[model samples]
Target: MTEITLETRIAKSDEIVAGKIDDEFVMMSIDNGKYYLMNPTGSRIWALLDEPRTIGELCAVLTGEFKITAADCQKEVVEFIDQLAARQVVKVG
Candidate 1:
């Protein structure tokens, strides 16, 4: 697996089915039949994944919307994306 960096582009995996309920996002991996739930911030990231985006781009947008420093946002976002990638809910390139 490729390491996720600031320049890495990411998008939702085709094998994952997802939906929004109220303020949260729920997703299921067709390959494993495992379900996942996301908080508001994660939901926002999921929505942004409608188009492939660089990790840097995601951090930029999220920092603008939330009160977080660039470094902290990048760290958190990278960790979150790593989890999603591991679950095959997202594709990283």
Candidate 2:
């Protein structure tokens, strides 16, 4: 199994807010004031964002849940993590 790396721990589930916009969903980190508009795949990724998970773990879960290839999940998940990290919504641990 691939090792996972979680940049930041989610402080509180309540600290995050989500809503659907058209066919997509938008999520925000209230504490950091960062906002992300996600498609279905991204939305699913956000749903599993938890304090105890890493990017790799999240990708693994995605593979199992979505029946996607590990390589594809890893690539997309890494990109998503990069964006979130850049926004300061997540930090390297």
Q: Best by TM-score, which number?
A: 1
Q: Each prediction's Cα lDDT score?
A: 0.94, 0.65
Error of 1 at 5 (Å): 1.0
lDDT of 2 by residue, 8-82 (tens): 332224656778776577878888787778888876666676454766678668888887798887777777766
The Cα RMSD in angstroms, rounded to one decimal, for candidate 1 relative to the true structure is 0.7
User: What TM-score would every model get versus the actual structure?
Assistant: 0.96, 0.63
Q: Write the per-residue lDDT of candidate 1 for residues 1-93, one digit (tens) a residue.
A: 889899999999999999999989998889999999999999999999999999999999999999999999999999999999988899999
lDDT of 1: 0.94
Model 1, C-alpha of 19: deviation from truth (Å): 0.8
- The regions of model 1 sitting more than 4 angstroms off are none
What are the clash counts of all predictions, listed in order? 0, 1
Weakest lDDT window of 10 consecutive positions for candidate 1 = 23-32
